[model samples]
Every structure is written in C-alpha cells, then in structure tokens.
Target: MSESKSAKSGGTAGSRAGGTEGAATSARIGVLKTYKLFVGGKFPRSESGRVYEVTDSKGNWLANPPLASRKDARDAVVAARKAVGGWSGATAYNRGQILYRIAEMLEGRREQFIGEVAAGEGLSRAKAAGRVDAAVDRWVWYAGWADKIAQVAGGANPVAGPFFNLSSPEPTGVVAVLAPRRCSFLGLVSVLAPVIVTGNTAVLVPSEERPLPALSLSEVLATSDLPGGVVNVLSGRASELGTPLAAHQDVNAIDLAGAGPELARDLEIAAADNLKRVVRPAPDREPDWRGDPGTARMLPFLETKTVWHPVGS
Candidate 1:
C-alpha cells in the first residue's frame, strides 16, 4: 500500500514539472520590426519596393532594411541640395545647437541602440553599450566644433600688394558618404557628424548588411531639430548607389571611407566628370573609424575662398 501511494505521489510531481515547463515555453514571440530608409526628414519605402534581410553576426534574421536604388540616391541628392542654402548658411551657433540636439535625442534612446549594436556585432551587452556611448560622445565632440572649425581652418593671409586678403572656409555643398561596413553606428556617426557639422548637407549610404541602427538614428534626427533634407540616409548596395552619385553632376563630393580599392578607383574616375572632391580610404582597407578623426575629415568638404579688398581708396 505504501509503495502504491509513493508511486502516485511521484507521478503527480512529474506531471506538475512538465506542466510548468510547457507553460514557460509558451511565452509570446516578439513581433519583428521593419526598417525603412530616411530621406528628406521622412521615412519612406524604397521606390524599388524591395527590402533585403539584415542578419545578426550569427546569421539570425534581424530585420528587413529597404534596398535603396539609384533613384533613391538621386532623390537624396536633390533633397540635400534643397537644404544646403539654409543649412549651410545658418549661423554657426545655430548649427551647434542642432548638433547638440542630436546628442540629446541619442541619449534618450541609448538602450535601444545598445541592443541593436549587441545583436549586429555579436558583442557583449557591456561592450555594445560602450560603443553606443562613444557614438553619442562623438556627436558632442563635433557639436563643439561647429562654431569653431571655421576659425581654425580659415584666417587672414599676408599680402604684399597693399590689400587685405582674407581666406574663409565654406561648405562644399552636397556630399555623398559611403558608411563603413563594420561598426555600423559608430562609423556612421563618425563620418556623418563631421560632414554636416561644418555646414554641409549630406546623402549617406548606410552599411548594407547592417542598417537597423542607422534607420533608428533617422528617427532621432527627425525629431532633433535638424532641418528637413539637411541629412538624408539610404540603406542599399554601396556599389549600385555609389556609381550614380559619383557621376551625378549635382553631387559636389564623395567620401569613399567604406569603398574597396576597385570601387573607389572607379568612383574617383567618375567624380572627375564634375571635378568633385574625393575622400578615399587607405589602399586595400576601410578606414580605422575608431581611431582619432582629426580635422582631416572636415577639411576636404570645405572650400577656401580668399577675398581681397583694396586697403587705400
């Protein structure tokens, strides 16, 4: 009788454990997210009506980011051009305020970025958070430069002809930037903040394989008091969009930080059609975006206009 009772008790315990395990396994699955492109301060589906699956470093499906086409790149350039006069001509103080606002928005959304970075790079949560923090800090660094870069890059030139010669740096107009393939967020911000902080408008091509953080960042920018069309971001194949942007007469410059040697060489050749200033990465490698980005990044996108006035009337 005692054996019979013990067997019943054991069976009951096993059944309870199984039920608990089944309940734990039944937790709801999360809804996946869809990432779109950001252009002219708005989120829009790619005109091509196509999206490419973005996967984690482990090859797990993450999200589908829009695959921007040449038409998208052209539209981005048009938007950038429309924003140039106002954005580039805005007072330095105003530009600084807008850049600081981007940092502010980023701070509020840090946790989301931390998660995205961790998944994209297969990094530990702590390391990913550190990267996110660094990206925000980079924006802060560039914010301070907005009002100061002109002073450091331009000044008076001594002239012998009884005239005052003044050299001043001005924005180089619309620049198309190819974001680095690795470290999506940090590299993107590093390339982008420097380009726009100096009063230039930009059309940025985010890393094709990992574009979630870049898409999210567009949300922050849209609400961060940055003027519409000042910064347009596209997610797609670099090779497809890059060629048209380089050849386009409207684009004033090209940043080849993410480009390989072959593509960079081809784009550089095409950019020559309009005599566009080209910023190429080191041979056979992407730029070390994590390293110090000195004034070199800013200098190429600026034009030095020297003005002279007769001293004696």
Candidate 2:
C-alpha cells in the first residue's frame, strides 16, 4: 500500500500528526459498511426490513446493522428458549471448555480489538489497548467460573430430621440481557458468561452506539462451539427489543441497562407482567462497560432451588 493509503487505513480513521486531527474519509479512501444481525448462528436483516447507520467515534460510516424489529426479537427469544434445555444439560466441565475457548479467541484478537476501540472509541492507543487486554482477561476469569459457581453458590443442606436436602444453582432457562450503554466488550462478556455458565441461554442486545464489538464477540461465540442459540445476540435499539423479552412468557429473566430512566421504567413494567427476575439500573451506563455481571447481575437473574426427599422408616 502507498504511504497515503497506509496512513488512512493504519488504525484510527483520523490522524494525530503534529497534534492535529484530520478526517481520513476522503472520497478516495476505501471503506466498507457492515449490515446484518447475528441470529441463530447466521447473519440476517430484520424481518420487518429496517437498517441504521453506525459511525465510528470519528463519525465515518462503519456499518448499517439490521434494525431488528419486534418480530426479530420474538425470533431471538425462540432461539434462546430452544437451546436452554440442552445447554443446561451439558456437563459443567464441558461448558467450561467451550467458554475458555472464548478467552483464547479474545486473547488472539487482543491487538486488533485494541486498535478497533482506539480508532472507534477515540481512546489513546495505550488506553484502548488496556481496555482490550482487560476485556480478554475478564473472559478468562469468567471461563473458570463455568465449572466453579456451583461450589460457591450451592451445597449440601442440613436437615432437621432423618431426611436429605440439597440445594444447587441451576440455569433459569432463557435469559434476556440489555447490555450496558458503555464498555461494550468487557461488559458484554461479563454479562454473557455468567448467564451461560449456569446453563442459561441468553438473548443479549448490544448497546446501539457500539454494536460492532458485540457482533465481533458473537463471531467468537459462534466459533467457540457454544451450541447455536445458547447465547444469541442482536444489535439494535434496546428499547426495540427490551419490552418483548421483559414480558415474554418464555423468557424467565431479564438483565436491564442501556440509556437512562425511561428505558429502565419500560423494562421494569414489562417484567412485572411475568414477575420476571430483573437486573436494576446503574448510574450513567455506557456502551463500553466493564464489570462482573455475575454477582450483581447474575444473582438476581438466578434462583435457588432446593430438592427435598424423605428417608422414612
């Protein structure tokens, strides 16, 4: 590639030479747009046929992902519900292996991701790289949990008489997650792993503004042999998808976030219809979020089930 082309395509869509920032999207520069939603192990447009432009932090056109409609949301919920039983039935050790592969894929793509975020989110090279690295590390942390959460949250129970009782953490069937409005990669993985680690199938909607990495994460999930539909993801307005899942009879729980108060209210009210377990709102959430969605997020989505049987004389 020539020096000019190389400069335009190197990393960020803008240059910081001589401490001056300039747009790299001259008509002559080559660019591409992404336009599809990852669903049911395939990429397709909204059934209602809508599309929206996504811009990099530089405002250069990045892609036009499908503007998933309510029908699309219903379809994704069907996918999640379909896979819940098989996913929950998988042995914990096997589940751990597949989740660990996600960590491996993320580690391999660390630099590319750092560069993407650096260019896409306008963070300095160092900060972007750090965020990418942290995101990968977070995946590894949760990978370990796939085989261990039960140890931490489940155990043998003491019975009052000559009877036996055992309490164990189990998948709550299908889950719906409204990813944080900030911190795309880390928060996405944090929210997803815990849901699936317990054997729950999740239908995750990425933050509208920063859906690229979420789609990329879906790519990794696809390759990792997570049973198709075990962890479905969509990139569109959360409001467009949130309401249906919060109230969907098949979805056992919903993790809420993205935007502000109005979105929260809609989710809470929708969830009330089913008494669906819901994750509450956070302060100033973003599309580039990072935190343990397990303790705080997963706990609420999960329920404690105790089995009691009597050994009588």
Candidate 3:
C-alpha cells in the first residue's frame, strides 16, 4: 500500500513538471522586426509617418514598409547629393574594394536574404537561393569593373593635329533608380550596383510589392563599408516618390527600370525639364535579370570628358 501511494505521488509530480514545461513554452513570445527607410546612412521613419501593407505574392500579410512621401523623396535626394562628391572622388580601386566588401557581407547573410526573397517573390527556397547567389555574384562582377571601366570606355584618341586628345568617363553625380518590380532581390541589385559602382550616388525605389528584400539589403549596405547616403533606399509607392525625384533639379539622371509605361512616359517628360540623362525602360518586355547585364546600364550614368594637351607638353 505504501509503494502504491509513492508511485501515485511520483506520477503526480511528473505530470506537474510536464504541465509547467508546456506553460513555459507557451509563454515565450517572438520579437517582431520593424522595417524602416535607409537614408543618409541611417534608418529613419518616413518623414510623413506613413506605412503601407506589404504582402507576399500569395497576398499573405508580410510587413508594413514606410510609405515615403514627397518630403521623404526630397530628403533622400539631399542625402544622395551630399554623398556624391566624396563617393565620386574616391579612387576607382577604392570603390572596387567597397563593392567587393558588399558581396562579402551579403554572402555572410545569404540565408536571411534567401528567406526574404522567397517570401517576397513567392519562390521556392531553392529558387530564392539562386537569386540571392546571383545578386552576390553581380556585386563582385561590378567590383571588377570599377577600376577597369575607364580603360574599356575611355582612351587616348588619334588626332591629326600636334595635340594629344584623351577622353575619360566621369560619374553623373546623383542618380535616381527605379528597381525592377520582378525578381526583387536580383533585379534590385542589378540596377543599383551599376549606378554606385561607377561613383554615382543613388536614390533607389525598390519593387513596391516585394520591398522587404530590398529593405533588408539596406542593412547589408550599412555594414558593408558603403557610405551612408551613397545608396538611399526608399520603400514606398514608386509613382509618389518618382514624381518628385524626376522633377528634382539636383538629380543628375534617372533609370526607369521599375516604372510602368504610363509612369515612365510622365517621368521622362519631367526629367526633360532639367535635361537629366534618362535610362528609358524597354517598351514591350523587361530584360531577363538572370541574363548578361553587360555595360549598357553603366554607360547611361557616365559622362565623357575630353582633354587636349600639346604633344610637346
């Protein structure tokens, strides 16, 4: 009878311990991450204090990204303009190192980016992993081009006169890039890397529907030795932000990769007001982000300057 009583007591204690463990597990809560805009090398809430719902391709609630206003767009321009001189004046080799560093940092965070990309674009984990890998490789490719673009794009020109004429490429100051709406991560990297790799600071608008991956990239940029304001990412309606950016006199050029036909038409007209260089989108179809990027995107943001010197001098 005593043994029977002791066994009952032991069973009761075990049951009580199991219940406590379950309660503790139930009490644990997850910490949610807050998304914000990346401007001037800092993460800031939108000046307008507005946010819009972001959903995955399946329309599942993801998170609310900042709804950048005209004021926010202007602020990003200010930040990009401020960074232009310093970033543009850096040696090509130094820029290459920084670009390479971004790739290194991105590789370290590969799994995180893969998850974000998968959710944002509604892709399988394997496909998203491929996109993330491509994005990292793109950065490394541009890094190699940083110090060598000048060699391929510029050189001494043969002249009949007794003077030497040399032409070289220079950054076009601040550029506004509309990141592609599809292939969110890879496409964003494709448009963004070329703009900044060549010394131009950028005000970028990520794919509106799939902006989480892009916002996450801002964190990578912050830690990758890239100067703040060198690449300002505004997560919001492209139409709202692109309007002010297109009309801003200080923005030296605009890439319409992410803009729709109607919006692209309007932005092109607005960009004409200040004679800004424009990279117009293809009228029919978007270029395959997975294909060879070539130098076409980089050329639009570069200006050629010719210098003449007497042969004797």
Candidate 4:
C-alpha cells in the first residue's frame, strides 16, 4: 500500500509541473511597436534605416522610433516647399475647416493620447488626460484664428498721401520648428498650429524623450485632410537635425524652441546664412505654453507686404 501511494504522489507532482510549464509557454509577450517618421503625409522609416529605443519615464521599454538624420531633414524641407503654394493659397475659411477637422479627429482618439501622454510624461492618468484635453482645445482655438488672423493683422493702411495702400500678412514659406522638450503635446501644438494656421508648411522635430505623442498626433494629421507635406514630423535627436535645417537655404524660417542656449545660438547664426526667420527662446526663461499663447507666437512667421496704387479716375 505504501509503495502504491508513493507512485501516485510522484505522478501528481509531475502533472502539476507540466501544467505550469504549459501555462508559461502560453503566456503572451507584447510585440514592441516601431514608430516611424511622418513625412509628406506618408509614414516612412528613416533613410538611414536606423532606429533608437524610446523608454518610458521609469526606463521601461516603450518603442523604437526612427532616428531621423540630416538627410531626413532636407527631405522634409523639400516636401514642405512643395506643399507651400497649395496650402498657403487655400482660402482662410478652408484652412479653418481643416484645422477643425484635426480637432475632431483628436477628439475621437482622446483616450489613446491620454494614455500616451501619461506614459511619456510620467504623469498620472488624470493629469495626462488634462494635457490631452488642453491639446485638443488648442486646435479649436487655432481653428478660429485661421480665419481671423488676417483681419486682425492685415488691413488697408491709412497712409499720409497715397492713392490706395493696403498691408497684407502672408506666410513666410517653409518653416522648420524644433518643438519644446518638456511639454510634449501642448508645447508642440502651441508652436506648430500658429505656423501652419497662417498657411506656412512646417517641418517639425519633436521632443526626443517624448516623441510618441507627436508621432501619434501625426497619424491624426495624416487623416484629417490637412494635406500631405503641409506638416512633416521627424522624430529623433534635435541636435542632429537642427543645424542642417537652419543652414538649408530653401527653409525660410525656423523656431528654435527646443535647443539649449549654446545650440540655439549656433542655430541662430546658421539661420543667418539664409536669413531664416528664427524665434529664439529667452535667456533662461522658457515660454509657458499652457498659458494663453496669444498672437505673439503667430506673428513671427508672417511677413507683411504693403501695396500702393494710384487712385483710379
């Protein structure tokens, strides 16, 4: 009887171990996602075929986003230049419609953004959600501005002695923007929307540590009828791409919001090569993107042209 009991016990133990092994084998391991750059409304891996790992705040593996190179920056500039005329020539009302469409799409995908922001920024769910909500509302705000900026900033000038004099604000062509590093979503939209709202095509380099949200946002822009090339997003180290963008003669303007003091100065000097319109950060003072970002941010990329004609008899 004792020998038979021992055999049964050993058999039961063996079955239990086998069951554990099967469970382990069946466990699901998440497939790591690869995020690519958004250029000319298309998703493409870096021309260099290189990718860098992006980790969460706690050092947890998040994704491997494409590491954009100087070549990518130049390509983005070319795309932006191609898109400039059509986008800038569109009616302001049409631009407003498209901007509003972005808001609508973002609304539909709010939860996804909230989760991304939470993970990317190391914020609580509630706080991250708040950031997403603000970002969506920012689009709505800029949508309204799209149709109103001209009225507020351009008009018939009352000249001392002129037949008919009018001042018009026009987009400054292709703009390269280095988005702020800390406030990934909000800061990005705050700078980007203004540039494009005025009808300028943009090449945006997002915050390195927090690029996932911007990459996801690019997906929204791609489907939102904003037109390809109007907004191209490159995700990688800003240091690698900034100088090339600044020095590119085809690029008409740049926003150095992401560069450190020394880098910002260097880029500003390079921008002088082509006389690029640069918006440099203040010394040791980062502009608060969350607060009301009035017309001050939008006016920099706009050029005012004055036209005068003799009064018709």
Provide the RMSD of all predictions against the true structure, rounded to 1 decimal.
9.4, 4.3, 9.4, 10.0
For all candidates in order, the CA lDDT equals 0.85, 0.73, 0.87, 0.85
Displacement of the residue 64 alpha carbon in candidate 1, Å? 0.6
Q: Please provide the root mean square deviation of candidate 4 (C-alpha atoms, Å).
A: 10.0
Residues 1-313, model 3: lDDT tens digits: 4324323322111112233433454553323467899999999999999999987677756677898898989999999999998999999999999999999999988867876787778777788889999999998999999999999889999999999999999999999999998879999999999999999999999999889878988999999889889999999988999999999999999999999999999999999999999998878777789999999889899999899999994
lDDT (Cα, tens digit) per residue for candidate 4, span 144-198: 9998998889999887874799888999999999999888898889989999999
Error of 2 at 109 (Å): 2.2
Model 2 scores a TM of 0.87
TM-scores for the candidates: 0.90, 0.87, 0.91, 0.90
lDDT per residue, candidate 1, 288-310, as tens digits? 66777889889999999999999
lDDT of the structure predicted as candidate 3: 0.87
User: Which ranges in model 1 have alpha carbons more than 4 Å from their true place?
Assistant: 1-31
lDDT of 3 at 121: 81
lDDT for predicted candidate 4 compared with the true structure: 0.85
Residue 301 CA displacement from its true place in model 1, Å: 0.2
Candidate 2 residue runs with Cα over 4 Å from true position: 1-33, 283-294, 311-313
